[model samples]
Target: MRISVVIPAHNEEAYLPRALGAVAAQTLKPLEVIVVDNASTDRTREVAEAHGARVVLCARKGVAFARQAGLLAARGEWVAMTDADSLPTERWLERLTARAGGAVALYGPLRFYGVSPFEATLSEQGYRAFLNLMALLGRPNLAGANMMLLKEAALWVGGFPEVEAREDVLLGWRLRRLGPVRYVPEALVLTSARRLQGGWGPFLLRQVRNLLGDPRGYFGEGGERER
Candidate 1:
């Protein structure tokens, strides 16, 4: 099956090239690369077009809306989701597809970049532990920055809700009811730690809220989904 990689970006001119470059270098080339310009005032659209990514404008201004627009515009059978500040591995798509047996949607861990060494290491270990705990509880957290889903499966569940955060997990919950949702550790991506600028105090609280499946994490801050 062909894969279409989708990126939701908002004024990510500085970081978008890395993501688009990774997509360009994927072992299994996606059928297309779509960059959803999430109401950005910068050169997001220009950068995406420069990298040969088809630009789709999401004027409503939210990750959920941007993702829904991508799901609708995607031409491939499966849609790969990643953030503007994230870099999927060279074989990220290949690995995810290889491990996908009966799973309709699956996500993997993220190794951070642009952050301290401690934060980078913590991201991997923390993700592993969280994945394990959520799997045991039957609520796999499909991160917006490192997950892949069948276009049909995602759309059938009403796409992403209009919430500010936890939209990825919400979609995962909906897909779990339809079929198995697996966590593949090998399908890793490198993400930016700009969001963690506040440090681990707020980070740990976000983790707790994530476990509780709370939608109020980034609600007041902005509509951008957690990266």
Candidate 2:
């Protein structure tokens, strides 16, 4: 099956090359690599084009908009989504494709990288514990940085919801109704821990607020789902 890798970038010139390199080195190569430049002020477009990736410029400034644009442009049987700052393992695509059967959507694990020792331990342990608890309750929150979806399945859900945050979770819920979403732990992606640079206290607090349905803290005031 043909797989298209879509990367949403915004001022990510410094990291785009590495992410694209990882894609090039994948054991199971993707049919195409698309970089959606989300109104970046930096050299994101130039870097992506330099890496031989097809760059699509999205005038909108949100990740969701960029992702939807890429999906619309994708011509592969399956679409894999990853952030500009994240890097997949050599076997990432191979593992995802292996697990794609019998499911409409697939999600893998995301590991935090480029962090201080203290921050890394805390972030990793905290998230693992939180996910374990959620699993026990039969609730799973999917991460966009390590997700794959069939093109038909994505179209059935009307594409991703153009929200500033938690779009992955919202879309996962919708896709789950159409078919099962398989979790493949072996297909891991390395994501930057820059969010922890702001301190875990504030980060965890914001996550808590968001989980509690505080729309202001999660999606901002009056932030409804976009078409």
CA lDDT of each prediction against the hidden true structure: 0.87, 0.80
* Residue-by-residue lDDT tens digits, candidate 1, 1-227: 78989999999999999899998998999999999999999999999999999999999988988999998999999999999999999989999999778888989998878777987898888878988898898989899999999888888877786677778887887789779888898998998888778987897787777789764543444333433
lDDT of 2 by residue, 103-202 (tens): 8888877768897677666665666666555445544556778889888887788777756777776666667778877777788788888866787688
User: Candidate 1: what lDDT?
Assistant: 0.87
Which ranges of candidate 2 are over 4 A from the true structure? 206-227
Q: Which parts of model 1 have CA positions greater than 4 angstroms off?
A: 214-227
Clashes per candidate, residues 3 or more apart or on different chains: 0, 0
TM-score of 2: 0.87
lDDT of 2: 0.80
